[model samples]
Target chain A: MRLSELSKRSGVSTATIKYYLREGLLPPGERITATQADYDEEHLRRLRLVRALVQVGRVPVATAREVLAAVEDESSDQLSRLGTAVGALPHGPTTTGDDAATERAGRTAEEVQRRLGWRIVPGNPAHRMLISSLATLIRLGYPCEVDHLLPYGRAAAGIAEHELALIGEFEAPTTQLEAAVALTVLYEPVLLALRRLAQAEEAGRRFGANRGAGADPAADAEGEG
Target chain B: MRLSELSKRSGVSTATIKYYLREGLLPPGERITATQADYDEEHLRRLRLVRALVQVGRVPVATAREVLAAVEDESSDQLSRLGTAVGALPHGPTTTGDDAATERAGRTAEEVQRRLGWRIVPGNPAHRMLISSLATLIRLGYPCEVDHLLPYGRAAAGIAEHELALIGEFEAPTTQLEAAVALTVLYEPVLLALRRLAQAEEAGRRFGANRGAGADPAADAEGEG
Candidate 1:
């Protein structure tokens, strides 16, 4: 297929396709004559994947390139493929808190992990995320209870199972990496959005039309005590 | 307490505190003299919340200001506080897919909600997020199954219950807003990070040393058939 046909088929503009080519996010099509080029089915698939990473995942072009690098490297195992893809995601914001807060946060996360019986490496980014979040909660004096962590962790595991199953359902080993990449980036926003909607509905039931947000500060102070 | 004391106590610099004051995200301290002012516990609390929103939540200053406005609105209900906080979050990237993709995405979300008996309102931001994600997935030819949505929704509901309980545990209605803000923004990243780590581990167990990513495209195609 000609470059025009590739663009037409993929719903991407020729100019943008050219941009991806220059950035090395897309491979060069076979040179037909002088300025014209011919692409194949693989080019279409690659272009679609690039768009998914760039547009859907909001991954930077460079990062998308990096992710694709992992996807194309058949030498790596599935776990390695996923690890590389995840590593390519931008790291979260810097965590800044005092020593006490950091220590408390780390302890809470450790305790949560221990209680859950999931053996996460200390170096997992989730540890950083958990500690950072805990630090903020502690600093703000709204320290989360083990009550929340136990249930939250369990619930997260349930979703993780679904994610794994989804990845498992793909038949072609070749397509699995793409499925993983797409599913990994796509679902969080969906889950988060659902969470927001759920919270809003619950808030409506709890604090709407009567007591504001169900705030009974004296009761809270009692709980704290 | 002086601004210096506030800085030392909160771990925020005086310049940023002044900027918050200038932005009206924080109220001015009591005027003690021409050049210096006295901050009290309230200033300290407000500053801490500002840092959580700005540094931890990564909410933009304008959005943080909007959230603070919501937080300070004593008349609003807990639900209103949550709504305001969510509203203060910048909406996700603008969806740029064509019309068919949008329609299919919306239908997918609507179908999932219907199947799950979740009564999310049409205008919910999550709806937009869901639709947008669905659109991206569909446009990229990685359609998500109701199988995935059914479980993901249920899991999110479990976490939502915990969130509501956490919010409920707070006695002061005023603090509920802050709690909502913290939990609302904090947990998603935590959840996402957990999902990644879990996917990696699960991928390791399922496909790491064995067949690659369990991808058997013929089997998948058969299942589809």
Candidate 2:
């Protein structure tokens, strides 16, 4: 099939298809003539995968490129690379310039891991991202701590794992590629939406003054001091 | 004390405090004279809350303003308004232009809610956001569905509620503010990170790449026909 046909079949526009091709997000189709190229089912699959990563997974283009490269590289040590990638958790507590707060966060991470009985490999990128976000909160004088957040993390992780286990029932896309696309496209939005809902609920609880008292002095002092 | 004292007490910088005041995110302190103003503990508390909303909660400043207004409003309708604001389910999949795909999404959302045994609100802003995101993926030609995502959402909601319940265990201010803060700052990131890990594990289960060969021929035809 030609580029236009591929675009029609994929519901992607010709221009965007060109962009994907130019960015090397899609493999080069066979050059049938000076002005024409033919794409195949494999190209369609690759395009879908790329779309899944960028559109649904919310990954940056460059990062998506790297992920695709990792996926396609047969020579790459998949398990080791995946472990390293997964190991870089980014959701732990961030270090607020205060040594005490930083120490508290470190201790809290350890405590949470121990309590949950999950290895929770340290230095995960997601962990760092979350911690940095918390550090930003602490710097701004909010009482953001890992201990305050640990149970939620543990519970969420447990539920997420359980849900993933049930994905085995999704008999579609038995191949790793299909599974990858399905999981990435389907579950990513669900997770993102859940977070958004949870955030809204939290906001309602916080800014909605009817539910609780004014504030806590000791907690405030502990957070600030 | 004066604004500077309030700043010192709150650990929020003078510039930020001024900005907050200007943005009406914080209220004016008592004017001691034309050139001087005095702030009380209330100011400190409010400042902390503002900091929490912005930093830990990641609420945008404009949205924060609305939330603060809702918080301060003492009308009986305020609670209902809060519920309305937070209780919005995602919009059910639209059917006018893309009826088939949207209908499928609606079915998926319903199935997810049914399986979870919770009233998964449709058309909720978060749900809308997720659906739109999924639509974008479908537009980009990924064979992902809402039902594939239902379990994840259900599980996440369960975990979040469980975590929220645990917040009541803390004493006073910690319980009051920290619970809200923990929900906002921690829940989403933890859930998202865990979901990512689950995806990685699913990818690890090399169930063979041909499993998608005959399943969902309609999806394959629509997507790659």
Candidate 3:
């Protein structure tokens, strides 16, 4: 197949595919002539991954390039490759200012990780993400205690386990990496939407027609009385 | 209290507070004189919510303003207020192109909602979010079936129940709304980070030193056989 067919099959525009080639996101196809190059199934697969990263994941081309390099770095073990790829993806907001809040956030993140008995890579952006959000929650008067978050961590771990099982169905490391990256980015909204829908449903179940009976007895007893 | 006290109590800058007042995201304090006005604890609470929306949630001030209006509209029942506020928040990517893919994504989202028995509001942005993300996954060759997502939905519902329980602990509707909005925004990064950390941990557990024994027995059997 040529670039045209690759573009057609991948449903990516020829020009955008060329741009990917120029950006080294898609490795150059085998040169067949002065004006033509032949692409293969690998190119199509890589193109789809690149499109998913750059377009669907909304990662910058630079970040996508870096993630791809991590994916293709065959020297690294599969576990390390998956970690590197996920770590390279853009993180949520970085924490800033208020050293005390930052410190509190760090301690809480450590506590959750510790409670979960998981060893996270040093300086994974998720650490910063957890810190940033937790810090905000603390500042805003919400209970930022680890007790509130541990259940969430456990649930997240279960979901992640399920997702990783899906990724492991792929035989090749590159395919696994692509699946990991795409699913990680894509399933995010699915998870979030489900959470929101569930919130609405749960809110309805608890508070819909019975405002007087809204609060759980335990929670009601613990309210600001 | 005065503007400075409100600023100090909320940990928001006076300039930002003034900006919020100007933007009407925060109501103006009662005018005591030309250059002096009295503020109250309600002002402080509103300021905190505004800060959470604009800074932590990263919603545009305009969107925050709309959300705040929904929160303050006491004429609406608490459930409607919560629904309105969550719905007003900016959603994930709006899906584009490939009408067939869009239709498939919509059907899939509807199926998941139906399976979960969630009656999602007819145009909730989460619906679009699910569609956008599911469409992307389908385009990328992943199994976008509802079965693959029902577990996620169930898990999400559980988390949402826990969260709403926390919100329910608040006695006042306004306070509950503030907690709901802030928790919804702030806990997002926390949830995402947990999932990523969990993915890393689960990956290590399953694949650390045993490549041949990587997949779960069930998933292994289902691999591209």
Q: Local distance difference test, per candidate?
A: 0.74, 0.55, 0.82
- Each candidate's interface RMSD (Å, one decimal) is 10.0, 13.0, 8.3
How do the residues B1-225 of candidate 3 rate in per-residue lDDT, one tens digit apiece? 988888777788889888888999888889999999899988887777878778877899889988998898999988889889988887878755666787888888887877777774657777777888888877766779888998899889789989988998988988998889878887888899889888887888776867635554333223221
Best by TM-score: 3
Candidate 2, superposed: residue stretches over 4 Å from native? A81-99, A134-151, A159-186, A195-225, B55-58, B77-81, B84-99, B120-123, B137-147, B166-182, B194-225
| lDDT string, candidate 3, A105-198, tens digits | 8888887887777774558787778888888887876789988998899889889888888888888878988888888887888898888888
Off by over 4 Å in 3: A96-98, A210-225, B96-98, B210-225
Position A149, candidate 3: lDDT: 96
- State the TM-score for model 3: 0.91
TM-score of every prediction relative to native? 0.85, 0.72, 0.91
| lDDT (10s digit) by residue, model 2, range A69-138 | 6556556454444443333322334444555545555455445444544344455554454445544445
- lDDT tens digits by residue: candidate 1, B1-225: 999999998888889888999998889889989999999987887787788778777788988988888887878655766787777775575364559988877877877766655564777667787788777777677757666687777777677777887778766876777777877876666677666666665676567656545554234213210
Chain B TM-score list for all models: 0.85, 0.63, 0.88
- Candidates 1 and 3, the one with greater DockQ: 3
Q: Candidate 1's C-alpha lDDT? A: 0.74
